[model samples]
Target chain A: MDRSNAMPTVLHAPISPADIAPFKIGDVVYISGVLYTARDKAHDRMLADPHLPFSLQDACIYHSGPLIVKEGDTYRVVSAGPTTSARMNAQTPSIVKQGVTAIIGKGGMSQEVARSFAGRCMYLAFTGGCGMLAREKIVEVLDVYYAELGATEAVWKLKVLNFGPLLVAIDSRGDSIYETVRARSHERLLRLIAERKRAL
Target chain B: MPSHREAFILHVAQALQEAETRLPRDVTRALANAAKVESNDRAKEQICTILENVKLAGAAGLPMCQDTGVPIFFVEIGREANIDFGLKEALATAVQRATDAVPLRKHAVYPLTRRSCDEPLFDMICDVSEGNRLSVAVLVKGAGSENVSALAMLEPLQDVRPFVLNTIWESGGKPCPPIIVGLGIGSTFDGCARLAKRTLLRSLEEDQSPFEAEILEQINELGIGPMGLGGDTTALRVFVEEAPCHTAMLPVAVAVQCWADRKARFSIKL
Candidate 1:
């Protein structure tokens, strides 16, 4: 809950562990630099392949399935928004183990995934459905990998500029905003249900 | 000039683009109000970004969100229109054209094989109306909210409140709250699910009944807030559409819609 700094932290990708160390849950961040898009299928493929075409060292993984179209010679990103991240929960820790230091997505991730960030990772929450905003930040579509996975599921290498207003929802210490919200909300739900039972 | 059937197909494509790019007026107003009331900095920021995204999408004529979603069409055909064309086939063609024209994400895939489908992704529900006007509306539904939607066949005495609350709780930020909840009560299993999904098309500008308001209040009370980071605006509205069912059955379905609330409509007088 330390949102003391009014300014958003500017992060450059290939984000290092040290770069993410100062930020905590509830802080805001903006990313500028290289990131890769990896959804459910891409995650499976990335982990299964022994030799990935791209390196994962200090890489920033974006849980997105961008709407990209080919324009004769090159690809154009139409609308690139974060997909639900919880679905990637299982594959995430393994990806983190491969030296991923930053993950940008919506809907947050699992507690297990939070625990996976214990020492060298952070999860940034982008507003869901903000595809146009995301598109604005993406300066270039560097390349595409795994085109066979379909445009939505393929791994896209992108270069972005100040790509955020992302909330630091999970810190390296394993504290998570989603976990805290869920706990508080559960208590309220129980109270409301109890009142309902009594009324009945 | 294109044939009447061709014209109708083009209309559907235009409707798809309208639905994908612009947040409906009712939805935009609701989100604006929600933004004003949001006390938490995180929640406020999320709402503001959504508003900004909507503006940008509309201005640039881009799909508001990347997940343009499976296009669900609600077609109201006038009986006197004497429809000569294959409505379903025409709708399919429109979707295919829009896939490239509006640049919708090719979201449909084969269920088992998980490969891309040649046909554009869409669902259609048709209704017969009195006049000679064919009205078509589209709701672009994203997976995040649609996945969390639940249907429960509760006992006759079972209350609907708990099921609704529990669904929202389990959903957490996954559906991208502040969500719009559509509740279908007292119909057959599949019918109730349809009832719930259809309710999502209703404009938020419409008034809510006390029951709908109460459920809405209770849901927001869960404090799941925007993106479930926690706050007062878990859901902007709750719409309930109920149908009488057998005495032994109390089927309820919850259809969750994300904040985008993207929808558009077009009417043709034949």
Candidate 2:
């Protein structure tokens, strides 16, 4: 697969669970068209309310709260950084089951989310703190889903180009870079300590 | 006092903006240095690319990375200053300006509502004392590092060594290694949290206390290295902050890792 020619892949909102199951680890997806941007609160509301503002099938939720600067009739994104995705550990599995095909955010997802969404959805870990660079990918902000949620938490419909240099940290196969690194580090530390103790 | 207040706020704000614009300078530098020394080519290359990207962003006036984190102010007020100026309000205003001018990413979220501010400015956690001289430290911590922050409460009689090692090991490359470890001992949970933040204020070359300096040396020996890619430079720096605590409880909060430990400071006289 030639990565450079991988034009953005667009998926509509309200994606189904089955739709999310097929995406592999390295595939670069550009979720343009439509999707809701919800963080902790929005997630809670969706969990509580039977009817949400929009459906979740075939959907991709981005863990971001962008800073939007308004000009004339339109708003421009000044800084749209990816928030810490680990904070959404509790909510991701449910959201994934609810038809979230992919998640774009900084950092890695939890073990539970990866296990729950095994071979179903992939987590794209975009570089955190590169809001300006990330903004370049967004061609235009189509609509703001929840104005009341404020800029950081508002759901934004965006049109994106190559939008990402995102990495496949957590894949549909239930593999996670975070878990692997952590476990290996722990093992290495333990071995070093034991060796030191024996030498002493 | 008035002159001092004005000077302090303006200087602090300027320092913060400069810090943001530079974006992870020390971290980028440290990562590049680590890459040179690292044995793993893949990890070294990754670190190199990350450093290059950060440099490019700085040159282009783009954010070093995306998560322009919550602006945390670690302030130390001296015992003899008399000023009527509202520091908090001034800070808010400065932050608002910085958000627009430097164009920092908004990061604050309304706790109860879970609603985030489209243009967040002030998420001030102030520390006050009785003096005329004030020292302020600003650390714009990105979410990547913040995600790896951990706290451990140990028994008064138990040693803190194991807990520290475990936390860092667990953190792994998650915090973007070759990280800075901020250890806070003896304070209450909240106090420990503040201590951890305060620890980041120290220069990468400075150590707050002797014990802390020793612990830092030990931690770097872990070999977590830059980007957790592995090397001798596991930690670029380690700062420890301690306070008095209860007899029965020895609260040790280890802010395990911060990838881009971006910090700047200013002093004011009133």
Candidate 3:
């Protein structure tokens, strides 16, 4: 509950595993520099393909499918926001093994995926559905990969500038805020059910 | 007179674009109010970012969310309208045009195979009414919130409250927090889901009944908070829509809407 310095700590991509390693569940941080986008299809491809289109060593992968329109051979991002990460739970552990230091998305991942972050990576919870906010942080779309998957699932390599007010939902130590919150909520739910039973 | 067919198509596309880029007033007001009262620092921060996102989208004239959701249209057609356009075909074409006009995300997929396509996607519920005008309201339902929606057939005399609460609780942060709950009670299973889905299009400014108020209070007490990060505003509101059911059945459907509950409406005089 330390509210000191409400502003998030600024981070740049291509960060060392140890750089994001210090962040705990609930630490507020911002990211700038290079990141790559990958959604469900991209996840499947990244795991099955022998060669990845781009390197992921100590890279940051954002769970996003941005809305981009081409302008004279360049892609101008109209809206770029994180998609739900839970859908990628099955593939995330393997993706992290590719040397991804941090993962950014909304609606935090499952326990199985969090376990994969044990001393290797962290998960950043971007504000869900905030394409406008995310777009401001993203300065440019440098390149895109896997266009065959359609626009929403393509992996867009992006150059960002101070790109986040990312909430650390999962720490490198394997703690997930989603789990903690669900547990607390479940306890209250039981109490609620008991109250209903008594009333009946 | 202009081409009613072309005009109608433009009308639907405009509604889709409006739904994409703008936050309807009621939804925006609720988010602002939720942000002001949220107690947890983390939850407050989430609200701040959401509020900032709203402003950013307005300034940029782009979609407030990249998901852009599946465009769902509620079409009310006038019975007396002198119309030659095939209503269904016109709507489908409008949706496809808007998919690019609004630059909506290419998200249509083959449900069975999960194969993605550039198809113009939309679902419509049509009703014939007594006027010479067609009214369409589009709701942009992003998948994050759409995936958590639920329907249940409770035993007769059983309470629907617990079912609704449980659905929201189980969803946790998956649907995004500070969500809107639309409850469709007492209909057939699929019918209940439709009832619940339609209620989400209603304005939050409308007066809430006692039951609606009660459910809203109980849900916020779950302490799921904003973004499920922990705080006062797990759900901004709960809307209940009910219909007559058979004596043996008590059906309930929960349609969840995220904080980015984007919707818009347009009426054309044909």
Q: Please give, for every candidate in the order listed, the TM-score of chain B alone compared with the true chain B.
A: 0.97, 0.83, 0.97
List the candidate 1 regions with Cα displacement exceeding 4 Å: A1-7, B1-3
- lDDT tens string, model 1, A69-178? 99999889899989999999999999999999999999989999999987899999999999999999999999999999999999999999999888999999999999
Candidate 2 — which residues are off by over 4 angstroms?
A1-36, A45-57, A189-200, B1-5, B40-42, B60-66, B76-84, B104-134, B142-148, B172-178, B186-194, B206-235, B241-249, B268-270
DockQ, Cα level, model 1: 0.92
Q: Write the per-residue lDDT of candidate 1 for residues B1-270, one digit (tens) a residue.
A: 335799899999999988999889999999999989888877888898999999999999999899989889999999998677899999999999988897989878999999988787789998998999999989889999999999999999998899999999999999989899999998799999989989999989799999999999999999999998899999999999999999999999999999988888999988
lDDT of 3: 0.88
Query: Which of 1 and 3 is the better model by TM-score?
Result: 1
Positional deviation of residue A105's Cα in model 1 after best superposition, in angstroms: 0.3
iRMS values for every prediction: 0.6, 3.4, 1.0
What DockQ does each candidate score versus the true complex, computed on alpha carbons?
0.92, 0.27, 0.80
What Cα-based lDDT does every candidate model obtain? 0.92, 0.67, 0.88
Query: Chain A TM-scores, one per candidate?
Result: 0.96, 0.81, 0.95
Model 2 lDDT, residue B162, Cα = 71
The numbered model that scores best in DockQ is 1
Q: Give one digit per residue, the lDDT tens place, for model 2 in B129-149.
A: 876877777888766676667
Model 3: how far residue A146 lies from native, Å: 1.6
Residues B161-180 of candidate 3: C-alpha lDDT, one tens digit per residue: 88988998988888888899
- Tell me how far the alpha carbon of residue A134 in candidate 3 is from the true structure, in angstroms, after superposition: 1.1
**lDDT at position B29, candidate 1:** 94
